[model samples]
Target chain A: AQRVTQPEKLLSVFKGAPVELKCNYSYSGSPELFWYVQYSRQRLQLLLRHISRESIKGFTADLNKGETSFHLKKPFAQEEDSAMYYCAPPDSWGKLQFGAGTQVVVTP
Target chain B: EAGVTQSPTHLIKTRGQQATLRCSPISGHTSVYWYQQALGLGLQFLLWYDEGEERNRGNFPPRFSGRQFPNYSSELNVNALELEDSTLYLCASSLGVGSNQPQHFGDGTRLSIL
Candidate 1:
């Protein structure tokens, strides 16, 4: 079965420190992955997608098919970056298979 | 434009009772998806509807049922709710089937079953 795994449940970091949240998936097709974030008291929103290869809010994720991973990275964490991040890969029918989100806490 | 919207921010019910949650998709969106956000289960896809038809569903019991209307608004009815059913039910919307559009989520309805 196709599945997305976010190994970290919580990541603690100080302001200006680099942060990386790991995600691995098991799927059989040309994978298209996306990252979604939910900040405190806010609705969930799309952060970035692998296909676009674009950075948003200083975060970028690269799809490594060989490793079956699409890890989110931020060179310098910010206080506003503290939020819940989920790595999702759409299923064959386009339903997002979300991982067990990782909560990132960037303190000042 | 307004994003996806869900009704009744919070609901409290007892076991064996039924709970009905509503979701209104974004204007022009034709697909609505329901997910269960529990404490540890992350987000489990519950159902997907498009054009007033049930397109897909997750590994949930029959008690977890829902439908979509012509306007693309959706209703999720949880019958015979259990204690474990306490969760944040989230509703999301996207473009029609086959359209590669990201889903927009609502604030979610927090269902608490005693």
Candidate 2:
């Protein structure tokens, strides 16, 4: 079975500081990973996907096959970046197996 | 184009009653997925539908069932609802059934069972 693990349930950081949300997965095959974000009172939305290799809102995640990790990172965190971040792996039918999520609190 | 849309932004039900949730996929999207986001439980995959057929299901019981329509819309039905069933039901859409594309989610219907 494919499983995703997000070690942190909550992460607090000061504005302008670097942020990294750890995520690890167990999958036998080459897995596609994604970082999804949910702002207060907003729907869950895609932040970035490993396949796309693109950064959004200063956030980027590298798929490290050796570590089986796809940790989300930002050079400098912003106050508005506070939100719930979920790490998910897609199944064969596109169903997502999501982690418990990390609540990022960026303090100004 | 409009993103995925789910009806009944909020729903209230009683124990032993049935609850039905609806979803309309984005334009040109043929695949729909359902997920349950309960308080403190995070997100749990419920079902996956593609081309008007049930492609996959989670470990949930048979009471948790759903179907995809020809137009690519879908409905999730939960029979004999329990208090534990109260949670946010989210519907997502994608281009097809695979890991290649990321699914887009709706705001979700918040269901509260009393």
Candidate 3:
């Protein structure tokens, strides 16, 4: 079975500190990974995808095929970056399997 | 252009009653997906519809069924609803059935089953 795992339910970091939200997946095919974010009082939106190799809102994720991981990382966390992040793996048919999501809180 | 839209932002119903949720995909999107997001649980795929056909479905009971209309609008029907069915139902739309396009979501409908 294909599954995406987000280990942390909630992660807290001080402003200007580094932040890393872990994500791992189990799949047999050439997996396509994505990161989706939902800010408070806002709808869920796409953040970035591994295939595009692009970073959005100062956050970037690299697909580690050997480790089967696509962890989201940021060098300097900002207060505005606090939000719920979800790691998703879209199947060949475009059905997205999402992780439980990790809530990040950046303290000032 | 407007993004994906879902009707009935919030609903309250008793157990055993039926509930219907509607979704309207983006103007040109041919694929619509339904998901259930229970509190503290990840989003679970419910159904996938494309071009007025049921393309795929998740591990759900027969009572959880839905259909797509000719215009690509979709409806999810849950019969004999259970307390566990209370969840935030989300609808998403994509250009087609592939990874080339990202799925855009609408503000979900929060269903409360008593």
Top candidate by DockQ: 2
| Fraction of real interface contacts that model 1 preserves | 0.55
TM-score of chain B of 1: 0.97
Q: Give the DockQ-based CAPRI class for model 1.
A: medium
The candidate that wins on TM-score is 2
Error of 3 at A22 (Å): 1.2
* Candidate 3: tens digits of C-alpha lDDT, residues A9-103: 99999999999999998873655678999898888899988777755899999788898898999999999999999998766555777899999
Ten residues in sequence with the least summed lDDT for candidate 3 chain B: B94-103
* Candidate 3 lDDT by residue in tens digits, B1-114: 999999899999999999999999999999999999876786889999999999999999999999999899999999999999988999999887776577899999999998
- The DockQ figures for the candidates are 0.62, 0.72, 0.70
Candidate 1: Cα lDDT at B92: 95
Model 1 — interface RMS deviation?
1.8
**Winner on TM-score (2 vs 3):** 2
Interface Cα RMSD per model, in Å? Answer: 1.8, 1.6, 1.5
Residue-level lDDT of model 1, residues B1-114, one tens digit each, is 999999989999999999999999999999999999887678899999999999998999999999999899999999999999998999999888753467889999999998
TM-scores of chain A, one for each prediction: 0.93, 0.91, 0.92
lDDT of 2 by residue, B1-114 (tens): 899999999999999999999999999999999999986778998999999999989889999999999999999999999998989999999998677778899999999999
TM-score of chain B taken alone, every candidate:
0.97, 0.97, 0.96
For model 3, the DockQ equals 0.70
